[model samples]
Target chain A: MSSEVRRIRYSPPWGDASIIGVAGSSGSGKTSLALAIVASLNLPWVVIMSMDSFYKPLNAEQSAIAFRNEYDFDSPEAIDFDILVDRLRDIKQGRVAEIPIYSFEKHNRIEKTTSIYSPHVLILEGIFALHDQRVLDLLDLKIFAEADADLCLSRRLVRDVKERGRDIEGCIKQWFGYVKPNFYKYVSPQREIADVIIPRGIENTVAISMVSGQIQKTLAHKSAQHQEQLQRLGKIAEDAPLSPNAIILPQTNQVKGIHTLLMDPKTSTEEYIFYFDRLVTLLVEKAVDFLPSHPEQVITPAGNVYMGLKTSVGTSAVVILRGGSAFETGLRRTIPDCRTGRILIQTNYRTGEPELHYRALPKNIAEDGLVLLLDPQMSSGGAALMAVRVLVDHGVPEDRIVFVTYLAGPVGVNRVLSVFPEVRVVVARMGDDMEERWVESRYLGC
Target chain B: MTDNTAPSQSVGPEYLPIGRKPTATVSTNLAHDNVTILPQTSQLIALLTMIRDKNTGRADFIFHSNRIIRLLVEEGLNHLPVVEHTITTPVGRTYSGVKFEGKICGVSIMRAGESMEQALRECCRSVRIGKILIQRDEETSKPKLYYDKLPEDIAERWVLLLDPMLATGGSALMAVEVLKSRGVPEDHILFLNLIASPEGAKNFAERFPKVRVVTAFVDMGLDEKNYIVPGLGDFGDRFYTM
Candidate 1:
């Protein structure tokens, strides 16, 4: 295995989230500009991560200053750039990042946090969105929303009075004392680095459309790379022998009997469903048997000590939907109380690329002792690879995952294992790598 | 069980065409304990008519049958217990409501039984499903369990036993026995089907008095072929082959 080693990884369309920094003076419509771009794109994956969420908690003196409307919140020093940059980097690398929630009314950070993951485009909008060098390095597009100074102050007065409950005098006090001055000292300088300067903010339809177009283009390019990477891995997998981690159930008569019935086209749908389900249950049991366990003594009903073993960690499963739906019966059979998460990765008809349509994973799946990726069959392993990548991205360790399938071609098995050598593959039988997926439809009957 | 749990709608009996009601022909079968036949409504009758007609094409058959199956599943869900739940509204007010008290899963009898699986899925998100195959032993010529894949925690969940047709009731009885062996309470199991013969209904309710049977239509009786008359012929064959 060590003699011919090659490492490859599949990157989803949102793998490297394009960070777009929207910086401008307070009340200049930075948020509105981000919203406009998102509205034009009309995509669910374009997330607007407000830099306001990263506002640093204030000490007693600073809190008092903030209460008096004398705090320089518009300045770069007032924002926690270190934490902001750390999270931005995590998003850029397609990893989970917890963003702190700040309360402007309380002038402090809240105890709870919100998380960001798998965003196709993240609009980092705030007065100092582009001030940090580290942030500038991660940003793919830099936008500066501009408006007249008088207009900015008036918008601030209306917003503070209605939403923040600020008195008119204090709003004016902060406008001149901190916000106005900070715009010149720290916020205004960011415009020099901005790629697009849109005056009148959201009213600039041409600018918003341009920004949205660029983002769509970037996404299309990333999707192309993902498809190419999958094919590259497949080519490597095609020539290699099955990974040692790919474990096939022993060819017992029971296993063979089930497979024979399943492979026979003349078999009635009733018998096909029966045998396929039987095979799936056996596959799940085989996967469970592979989980690490420790032996202990327990008192039996006969008043005698019995030696038994228990798995060291709680196991959860992620069902790759549609096809994975076929495994629901078997999965319940093996672990009736098992927590299950679902990920739907559908192969695009036009491109033969597996695109992730939806995912709802169990909480803290990365911490699970074992995570089984359930799919009834694997041919080219396109969906399986994407599904595994999802779990790994969500924090599940590669080694802790076991790809459970009723039938898998050698190419598909090798493809998944070659990319994730540590992960184990539990299969019932092996056949044509390019075989059309018929079992999920056969079993699901839809 | 009485009709108290039946969900009422503004679309009333006035809409049902005369002499075309689900309850009309199945009154005799309803005398069996723990059996609930779907209420008579023109919408349901129309769907049954499309499926039962021999001239109905495959696409029409599947589409109409699925609609009826969806209704059967919704009715089946009414039997599940619910607990009062209080939730706060976004307007800073709280309202009391009810939520399902326990988890539920579907256990489909293979082939024809799998037809109901999709309907159950449409009603419940990520609901776990199990499968049981009880076919004749061939040698002994008796219904024997070939395989059963039940959830590990089935004993704790209300099991929706799915099979499209109920005729002779041998396979269903064997399936119920399998559930009992797995520690599932008889009352917790709801046998959901599209149609059932009178003989099968009587035989099933008598064998397991606690397991409720919820069917869309109860046909007159079984024919010599042991198939439900006026019932869509060979549910598994029609469902899969079509």
Candidate 2:
């Protein structure tokens, strides 16, 4: 029934990743400036992406000059802005992106690429960060790190001769010939468009706080929007009948008996655990009926051949951590060797919005015949939608996935089904949408 | 095998059967080669007394009986085999240890046996459980298989055979036969129960020496009606219905 219900389009908080571009002359403390901003924000999702990693691989002729420190590394032409812009666009939309690892010593791009996913804010630090028009379009905040010209030259001299294995002459030669000229022609012009300019870079606390405050405000705005979106979706799902995709266990005497024990206030902890786990087993068992099977035959001890649809294959599970951990026993009981993965989505206590904290999925999950998303309780279905979005982004087909939970509200189930109409949900019981999650705390004993 | 000459195995690495799977609130009494009865400790006896009383309600019977059932299941896991394992500690020194190493499933005799399913699932997570229903032939007074549903890979897993009361060894014996016919080795099955008649324990042990038996209590013997003397009445009726 949820399929015919109004659907709400959703994008995770990470989907609209904010981009901050930091540009400066070589040795002008741009790296320090970005780090200071990160320290002020005090967030894990804020990432610092170096523009040096996107440097164009030099030809043999240019490489020889670079070896002599005679090549122009400071010029915007040397930075591969195309790949940089593509990576920025990917982060802006919360897609997994591979960043090239360029080797300065070898003057070539390494074969390996570091993967980045779900970054909420990226600090693109390089001389050309604000130089490219495509990159400028993606920037949410622009910062130009400034330092004295003589100071920058001296810092470059100390940095190169001591750390980069360059001689004093080569350092000075590159500083005057390439770095000095590039700052005037290409780098200085970016300062005109910068939202904030930091003089003395990391030492300028006033500027750092101002920039961090603006970013924090932006995050608060996004979080408020996310919570509003969830409430809107919940309202749409409030009265809709459960979709056929939600396969609750047949309410037989056995299932009802377990439910009574679970709901009773006087049930002992041991019995509560036993019956809950038993109920979980039955729920997962019902979930198997949703899995596709092929006909196969087995010979009984009586030497008679009987055809069976399937013994189970190619099925894996993704546990939405903590609450989902409660489903492990039930999952293990049903599929003893079933491969498992984990995704941690926690609610913001103040904002009432769910945030994706961490995720580690099994290899080639998209290829699995079926994937079960396990969580013991659902009220708002905010986390469910995000969890489903995570799986969909990872290449698992929506139709091949199932969200399994022990207790859920109609609105939560309807909301998830409305967005992912193809994906089914298996819940043991329907309870109040406002009911708090106590099953996991009781089961985990924490 | 009943003497636990074989080591215990778990899902992780397994070395030697360091000791029997710990029985937190119960201790071993008989220690026979194939049978283990919970010793009459003050703790064990008190729990037994509550369930044995005829006036005891279903709620108390279930609560007390489950305590012993948990112990029986742990004792059942004790008979599996284990392999030697070594690991490096955080202090950067090697520590020789052992871990469990095998898959396990439960087979519950339907009706009464079904009561023990939760306990099995409690001790073992996501444990695949099969159901077997047996009824006595009124004329022959013999156990007969009425229905059964089991895991497809039963032959390869360590089986925990669950039945609350063992009397006359009739149902337990027939249950083992059903498992063995399905290719599960006699040694791989561990019969777990809350109470047993001495006659029942003896008959079961003599029949299947390889299948280990773990019970919480062993009463004196069976009466003419085949009911265990001083035993809790019709366990299924008391536990399921009021």
Candidate 3:
């Protein structure tokens, strides 16, 4: 198998796993066929779990009857379905499961149990595997192994006599009395649910190969879909021209000086904080200019009317957490009475997906004439997108929201603008490289 | 002559100006871009602060309310349509300038809306004025139009719908319906208010998207009593000393 396929096969617990279930009556070679497929796949991450391990431990009287071939083990009621369903669900969710070990000779569970963790491929082989609805629901693929009734009985006779230490007459009588009747009643009916039927059981190598190929194709498709989603999230409009919705503050010497301090690697944390404050003030001031204003005339001290512009409405500011909080002081300084709200969004370290941890906005923030969305830095724009979605869902008008950031990449800004075109974006500086500083600081671990 | 044969491109039953699409399409939410919130100028903010203060007496309240309303009306008129014209300067040189286009009219939703009428008339002298008396049924909370007196040729004029407070937009919507019934196109109407709640503005825009909304400020939302919170309490009650 290719390394990419292997990576998926041994992916994290939350990753998708392909579950194949094989079902057939005794002596139908269901276990043998499952083993052959596993070996052919040559996947160390594949796990095979036999249904025999789910058999209910028998009482002394029941054990004696089972040993004497008087007790029927082929019935669905003979298996502990509750435990089996629980373990299957656990494995499906990438969790560890403890499977019981059953001894056929003792007709009971052994003292020890086998711990099974999540695997890329999970195979469940048994006569009643397809009988339970719960088990069938968890399986991605179901295969039924079939053989001639006479041939199955002959094989059963040989195996029971040698491996099981059962006499010929006893095996024959038990097969006719319990096994054959139960197989027709319960196990044979499950063929209707089988996705693929192998007529010759283990000897049907062609059918096994086809089932394996189908599973591999499904896995490949899932992997491709996951990659596409990641690409969509990370995509930035680098080559495309800047969107009209973006408002890059004019590169004045003061603005450039602040950027120099912010971008310098040798700048101390205190100096970085101070310079960021200065930059944020400028960004907030620029964003305020976007609000609607009207011309006004006021009497001057010289008894002359002077025409001026006056702001028309109130504004509210919503800051994204951590980095976004840097703009809080600047926003307050600019609009002292402006209501402030906060949204906490963090990137999951393992999954790299942004998660909203918390959000607190002023009551009736939706009605505010303007909402200033503050985030100091935007890399992939994933967190900003999520924050914007939150505001939009709360009935805030998209165009009324002005997303203010100190520094942003072209990709992040474009990503947000594409999703929310009407939302205005104001940034002090626009950079092409998103992760250069982080990489230099060893924050991203290269 | 009424051009009834003109193709109706508007989404609603009311006629809108040709070639002007509804502004709601600019965003999925209420058209915020079409709604202009005046900047927080110190003079305006100071007046608003005085009006919102509980300790302010009726005289001060009325004085500040009128000042703010006049400022808001002046600001609102700036959004009205204008046409270019040329005139001879005293120096005998031709000066080109823009002049207000179309006739101007104001329809006030009584009694809160009546407070803004004086300011609107002050700015547009000799402007045609109209009144719409829509009272909320205290029990039902539904607006019932009791009376309306609009201009005869209102369809050809730019009508400014004036109200001091837009809480639930029930009265504003009724007033707009009355205006549209009078044959005034939605695009030719501008809804001007001192303060509005988001819900009220959203509801109004969703119903009459082509009409522009110019407000001094938008408070949070209405309380259970349907009054705007942090709002200058009941503009009509405070202005009339009721």
Candidate 4:
């Protein structure tokens, strides 16, 4: 085994920096050094993406070369720079991406993929993360971890022989013929472009500490920016009209009866279900009022029925499950033909905060269709707000989302309205006052 | 053939185990081996460092414990079968890598276990999540199930049961029992925590050796009141600021 290198520890975990890239020659201890930095930072949102994850599939010509050991896998031409740029962009925007998993034993790509979700700190570590201009554009900090060519070769020799199932003679031959020359020609030339370069790779404790401190300072700055956005959301009033397209349902006495049953602390579970379903039916009916209507007539047994209203656009009800799912039963009762989609959003009871659990919506939801965002209750409105945000991000128009809740307190209604003014709020009842925590009694009951 | 006591002659420095692939391909599999299971005392030190400091507010306490719990779970998962895989990129490219052994799910004990969700999310993205809320029955002091939502494919996945503090292990036991009823294999279950009492660990060890316990700290004896001594107060209360 190659002698163990000294471990360098970075102070203060990697802060909320957008991009941090690691670059080095073929066997320069880049992986080991990058891992040390990631471990020391201990940032949960950090994603260590490898440039090897972007290797180009072999063509007939390249496959023949690979078989003959004639292909230069270390060359920059070996990677897919477009996809690398795309993945980096997705990471920066805090979205999800399907990262490729590679295999060298068979010299082909594998079937299984890893889903990398929103990372707060993105650690792009690979040979070409810094070499390619397109890839480097996405990096906020560029680090080049360099080691002695002979030392790296020895580590590679041990690693290949013991771990990779390679023969000693073949490993040495490949290291000398292809790997070393590629490093000098393609990888080493990019060193001058790096913001920071370290000798002895991870063995340099001083370098690692300096990098860690810089990461912490960057993260502290980001946390402040996030706080500011949340503060702005706090200032926006809950009940304000979200947008001109908002379709507020008219309150009626039958609705009041349902609300009474829902709001009463003395209500039994049976009574709660009954009123909840009744309100759901009413909310579904009111949501239908927002869709485009076409002229139609109903036939009666005794005589021809007069012309009446019918929906023009196909309607789809997407329930944010389990609470919103309860509304599905009522939606079916009102419109038996309506298609249903489920999005699970659960509340962290302690923080009273909501998180997206699961979501499976229709592919064409954004294509001129009416979507009912049904929830049994909305309090603090975070889940409902996020649910709407998800749909919006997925291309569903804000006006297309009609939020129908059985009951909503002032706080939740205000939250949804403020975040998405164009979203319609239809409910059996809306409470006036919010508790100290901003949750209404009716919402709490649900 | 080499003598029995001799360092082998066949395994040389360049003895590649399989093919002409680079050593970097296999280096990743052994990266996390430096894992050390901190003793119960060390865990207490780590926890007390966070909770005892006047600077450690309710938010920071919950945050740091969550961080510690995530590491514990990741360490446990390291022992799983993560075979090397290859995948095609969206641009029709190929990449080689290693992935988790199987599908994973989280079953949290209501209240306390729920606080650990953010950390779990940070660790595994797009993980199919489930919940089992069982509170101690005030009258009987036995666990009473209030709510549960698990994926249909939960039986096929390894389940991680999360609870911040395990004192008597009653709630955790009940949760495991419930998951088994749902068809989760006993061996497929891993119980994770920020701190655990010996009584709970012993209870778990005796009841199901098949189930692994991944905890940051296994504290000394439980208090007369059944609280983990040097515990970070009532986890749920502290988490919710009650």
Question: Model 2 off-target regions past 4 Å?
Answer: A1-6, A58-65, A157-170, A294-313, B1-242
Residue-by-residue lDDT tens digits, candidate 2, B1-242: 02211111111001112242221212224446899775433335445655665666887778767766865775677567655455542223343444456788999998999888877766676899999999999989888999999999999998999999888888889999999999999999999988777778878988899989988876555666777655677889888985
Q: How are the candidates ranked when ordered by TM-score, highest leading? A: 2, 1, 4, 3
Model 4, position B83: C-alpha lDDT score = 52
What is the per-residue lDDT of model 2 for residues A1-446, given as tens digits with 9 covering 90 to 100? Answer: 33454555887778899999999988899988899889898877788999999999999999998997878888888988888888888889888788999987799999999877887788889988889899999999888999999888898888877776779998888888888888899999999999888899888889889988988888888788778888887877886778777877655444544555566545577777887887786677556544554333433222223222332448899999879998998787666777999999999798788888899989889998789999999888999999999998788998789899988888899989878888888888777676777778767767
lDDT of 1 by residue, B121-179 (tens): 75564899999998988898789998989899999999999988888899999999999
Look at candidate 4 and tell me the lDDT of residue B226. Answer: 77
* Two-chain DockQ for model 4: 0.01
RMSD in Å for all candidates: 21.2, 18.1, 21.5, 30.4
Off by over 4 Å in 3: A1-230, A233-236, A295-297, A300-303, A436-446, B1-242
| Weakest lDDT window of 10 consecutive positions for candidate 2 chain A | A300-309
TM-score of chain A of 2: 0.90
List, residue by residue over B25-136, the lDDT tens digit for candidate 3.
Answer: 0101234666877554434544565676555678777766775676566566766765554554222334344455577799888888888877665445578889999987
Question: Residue A223's C-alpha lDDT in candidate 4?
Answer: 50
lDDT of each: 0.78, 0.78, 0.71, 0.64
Model 1 Cα lDDT, one tens digit per residue, A1-446: 42244656667677888999999989999888999999998866789999989989999999998998888787778889999999998899888789999988899999999988778789999998889888999999998999999989999999989988889999899888889888899888888999989899888898888999999998788878888888888899989988878888776434544555566555677767766765676677567644544433333222222223333577899999888888887677546778999988888899888877788889988887889999988999989887888888888888789999987899998888888887788998876677777877777676
Give each model's clash number: 2, 17, 7, 18
- Measure candidate 4: CA RMSD: 30.4
Q: TM-score for model 2? A: 0.64
Q: Candidate 1, DockQ to 2 decimals? A: 0.01
Q: Quality of candidate 2's docking, in CAPRI categories?
A: incorrect
Best-matching candidate per DockQ: 2
